[model samples]
Target: MRVYPEQLGRHLTPLAQCYCLFGDDAWLIENARSQLLEAARQQGFEERISLEQDSGFNWNDLQNEWQALSLFASRRIIELTLPQAKPGADGSAMLTGLMAQPNPDLLLILRGPKLAAEQTNSKWFKTLDNAGVYVPCNTPEGQQYFRWLDGRITANRLMLDSDARQLLATLYEGNLLAAEQAVQLLALLAANRRVSAEELSQYFDDQSRFNVFQLSDALLGNQQQRVAHILAQLKAEGTALPIVLWAVFRELASLLQLKTAMVQRESLAPLWSKLRIWDKRKPLYEAALSRLSLPQIEAMLALSSTLELKLKQGGEEDWTLLTHLCLLFDASAHSALVDTRG
Candidate 1:
């Protein structure tokens, strides 16, 4: 049986057999593991959860451990964390046989990064899928993510007005786990008080690690002073170049999405709720929306891709690329769009 993170909340509690969780989202996988471990404990398998990683050990040795039963406990959970699993000859043979007759009282979990279709259909993958539950954990996106964030806020007993939530949504830049942590921390920080847009902005501007959203927000708001300041702060804080590049790319993607939605006569107001754009930054988004068109935003996103490739290949001039990105967004905000598709 396949399970998504969205359905895990409901489906997990009733699971009675061996299972495997496989997904790219580390946070979701970890959370799922925690739930399973807890549930197994409640079901009187307190000492069943055993963790293993693929890097240092023989798979057969670990397999044998899962084959053994606890003297005092009726069931056991064997968690194998292999970021990338390649079954050696011995491991492959052992796993193939194990699949034929899964231990009735032992649950086996295998987790790793995302796999291509070919990899997903590999011997071990198919074996796990057939013999036990395979929960695929993909990162949430778009409206699904917003719903997740809103749910998190409510779970924390912190009320986020639509605008405040939107602000946080934008601030998180699609990193749901980080966003969740930030909200939990904020809830503790403002115990017994509701979070506001103003409060969020102050924290975002002051404490946020540099990323695409921060840079784009700085540029969009026409805060040249802040932009310079943030770039310096990022350098001081030792943020990696590629991480910053990814964030910039994410911002460019959002801008393109925002532009496309607008051109389609889609209501930008709802996007605030969908994108989790807070009230304070809605004006900034509105201004950027008012100025940029779909074509123009797409062109800049194209430029971003080119720059990203160059940066990845040890392109000697990252500062130049950064300046160019800033200038393109700046130009979009100013005067009318030039037909620069040439």
Candidate 2:
């Protein structure tokens, strides 16, 4: 009964009696909820009673609402929004009881933040999972994000060449909502016209300014100044710190894996293929691998973890930590070049 966000649409026509949509991505979760609501409406669910879980929320009220018949519609939709994803003992008991017997007259939709493994494995959650569909709404990363962006462009009926797509991906890195808006804007400005990278650049001057991918490339290419400048630009643009950390951590992780493989005298072709690394990016990985030793990569990863901890502890040194990480890559590349010339 578990489904991904993409697969929720197909299941909507043949609606389940209940559904649980949980994740950290607000935009995606809301969109999926909207889709479900639309599907419910089409399926003759005319009455919707929404309940937001506050401190004063009573579980008995939910039971009452479920049992009460709606005069307007035979089938009703009950939406329960749990902001914390924690249904206490009473709530859990109520949910379990409700799911014990299927209610064909009512559709129960539970929306909430991501549930921890323990929460998901609870008896109440297991009961719901067996009875209804569970849709995950986690934020996409890397190629996943790219595919999502491409889908959005296609959905908007916007034609974008490969370069244009890459540019758009870079422009809206770590911000899917912004990416969606940009696609809509492009669709409006370039109706029935193919948008080239040049055109996209001209139209989205501010958004196209910088991206974390570019920063990663600069780090690998030993462009210290460019990396610093991009970091500053990304910070000024309010790019999420975690997004930047993820990009750098990903590159470092890739380099570490490749370096370890090379040390083991393993052919990298099959490994890269297994990793699903594109041929175009293979050279970037190669360049970084050649420049960074395994020990250096490990040290960088440890520093990255420290940065994460600092952020978690509410430290204001995010930019400082990120800048240091970038400079570490640049320094390693420069050191490698110097060693080669020696």
Candidate 3:
């Protein structure tokens, strides 16, 4: 009876007696719950009693509501919102009791935060899972995220070249809600035609709340505290780790190429134009080359490649390690971070 948000089928012409929607992705969870409510309403669930489960919640009220006749509608939806997804002893027993008894007139919806494995295995959850539909709405990552994005794109009938797709992904990787909004905008602006990355700037602005481009400036300028501050803001604001990683890696690659060219005593002006490092940001790169040795840049590039690969391969992010990687741009902190393996 378990279903993902995508597979909800808009389920229930004849509504299910009970439903459990739980997940970390608030957007997905909310959408799923709305589907259930709409489906329930279509099938004659005209009255809904929403109860927020807080410390002040009384289990007795739930039973009384269920037992008491609904003056408004014969068929009713009793939704219990468990903020932490954990219904303690009294709530568990009440839920189990309700499940044990069949009430054709009453529909139960238990909405909660993400489910841990232990909660999934619990007897009460087991009974509910068996009796009703359970939807796990965890955020998609890696290829799953791309698939989700592709689905969105296809739904909107917008064509994006590979570079355009990657550009879109980089712009709104972690925040799917924002990504969807961006996709909607693209549908309105650039639908039915393939677009390249370079073409995206005519319409799309950087959607990252923490301003990912600023991270590049901070890193290359060797502003250690500013880099840390921006990084912390990105993390706190739930910016995807991959987006920040992409920015840092691009700067590191540019630095490597420029530093190599400098060592060869070649003309740097043409290379600067090719690399798109104009007058304003040229000094930052120059300063970076002065501070970091060629080997150091190469080493950081290698580590960054490894980190990005780990993410692509579905590995958990190590934020502390990423913070250390950004700090590597500061020659003063680089040695200590390298020694401590930060």
Q: What pairs collide in candidate 2?
A: none
Q: What is candidate 2's lDDT per residue for 102-172, written digit by digit as tens?
A: 88879999999989999899988888999989998887765788888878988999999889988888777
- Please list the residue runs of candidate 1 whose C-alpha ends up more than 4 Å from where it truly belongs after superposition: 49-56, 191-193, 203-342
TM accuracy, model 2: 0.71
Backbone Cα, N, C clashes tallied per candidate: 8, 0, 0
The count of backbone overlaps in candidate 1 is 8
Candidates sorted by TM-score, best first:
2, 1, 3
lDDT of 3 by residue, 164-269 (tens): 9988876776567888888898888886778888888677755543467878987888878657767877997788898889898999989988999999998898
When sorted by lDDT, best at the front, the candidate numbers are: 2, 3, 1
What tens-digit string does per-residue lDDT give for candidate 1 at 92-139? 677777777756566676777766787677786777777767777766
Candidate 3 wrongly placed segments (more than 4 Å)? 205-342
Better of 1 and 2 by lDDT: 2
lDDT for each candidate structure: 0.68, 0.83, 0.83
> How much is the lDDT of residue 261 in candidate 2?
93
